[model samples]
Target: MKQVTPFLMFEGKAEEAMTFYCETIPDSSVLDVTRYGSGEGGPEGTVKLARVSISGLEVMVYNSPVHHAFTFTPSVSLYVDCSTEAELNGIVEALAKDGKFLMPLDNYGFSRRFAWLNDRFGVSWQINLA
Candidate 1:
């Protein structure tokens, strides 16, 4: 089957961010972590790319200091559909570290979920358990 995954770009915190994410999400794991210097077209010790999986969903994370002409905005976000309130809360809490919340975690008329700020790395996520 064809899969669509979210790709995240970090200035210089790809490794650290991936590690943190893996620790936060249950059954989440990181695949290959490639360094720049280890191959062509990257600086030494810097992460070139990494494949991470959370609940079987794959996400790509990369480190690119050269902004060139790209930037991250809140226009797009990843929505996580959780199975339980506890799982949803765990994700919200974990992603909230050093991150601000746009909306407080609470129960809405439609669903019980939390939507909030991007993490310290500026990645926005929506956690929902319906």
Candidate 2:
């Protein structure tokens, strides 16, 4: 009720994902991080919790101690509004590496250029040029 933010659950790749995202996106960075220590629920040095600002959007990242059968799905995705075509192209290329694309980059009628894909971390993203 107070506030709402997107939460990303990763098996053990939370830190990697955060770093990748911060590096790939402009004006993005890791705001804070809490790592697991000895005797903690998760593996030592792993990301117990992390807050990252991706292109001005604050998101929560966690390394879940328990593994599940499910993972990130295309139904829910991080939508990006790009300022330039070059930015869109760069982001799409970086995210699409070792990942699957649900919608390839093109003028999809709704936008000048757009692309929907799951990053290597399995997180879905929709990049658009407005």
Candidate 3:
């Protein structure tokens, strides 16, 4: 297991988001899924949380009805290092669909190809080809 895991809070969309994530990543699987109504400690009749694993990376997603209290920020982002330009471009293009592009794909000083964008779910990602 990894030492540190990313926990994402969703607004009544934990199941949907987790399903989408699992489908997007190759060989990804849902390790465990516990619904609120099924658990004694969780809120009644709601999806409290879910655990999804993608390529051995564990991610937790929880449905928190309180949306106003928290907002997704660019301060934290996932950076994917690609070995080839084609791989980087594919990731960038896929993530950019129905998403906001912070910087168009271009060459940077450190990398031959780079791009930053926030996916449809509001999670930001930085794709770079070294």
Candidate 4:
């Protein structure tokens, strides 16, 4: 069977992002981190590969050896189905520290509450209460 997982690529903040996610999100964990050794072109000890689980969903995280021309955009976002208002609000506060919200958490005829924002790592997230 074929398996698919969401992959997150970072210029150099993969490790930090992975750690942050694990801390900020409930039931999240970071595991199997492999660092780049010297002369691998990436900064030594940077995250070359890692697996992160957020709310039991797998995510492949890695630091790029080369700088990309572009970063993440709001076009593609990770949608989270929060079970409670507290969960949704907690995630919103944690991710909003260094980020800006595209749409503040509010009822927009779609759901009771929703928030769209790009995190500090430039990754977009859409959290909702359902």
Per-prediction CA RMSD (Å)? 2.4, 0.8, 3.1, 1.1
Name the lDDT of candidate 3: 0.77
Task: Please say which candidate is ahead in TM-score: 2 or 3.
Answer: 2
lDDT of each: 0.80, 0.96, 0.77, 0.91
Model 4 — which ten-residue stretch has the worst lDDT?
23-32
Model 3 steric clash pairs:
none
Pick the lDDT winner.
2
Reference-based TM-score of each model? 0.83, 0.97, 0.79, 0.94
Give the per-residue lDDT digits (tens) of candidate 1, residues 5-24: 78898877889999988887
Expressed as tens digits, the lDDT of each residue in 1-130 for candidate 3 is 6388899888777777778767654567888877776445546776687788865778888888665676577788877777777767777877888889887898777776889888888888888886
lDDT (10s digit) by residue, model 2, range 16-69: 999999999999999999999999989998899999999999999999999899
The count of residue-pair clashes in candidate 2 stands at 0
Winner on lDDT (3 vs 4): 4
Q: After superposition, how far is residue 37 of candidate 2 from its true place, in Å?
A: 1.0
Global fold similarity of model 1 (TM-score):
0.83
| Model 4 residue 32 lDDT score | 84
Q: Provide the lowest-lDDT 10-residue window in model 3.
A: 37-46
Worst ten in a row by lDDT for model 1: 65-74
Q: Candidate 4 lDDT, tens digit per residue, 67-104?
A: 88999999999899999999899999999999989999
- The residue ranges of model 2 lying beyond 4 angstroms of the native Cα positions read none
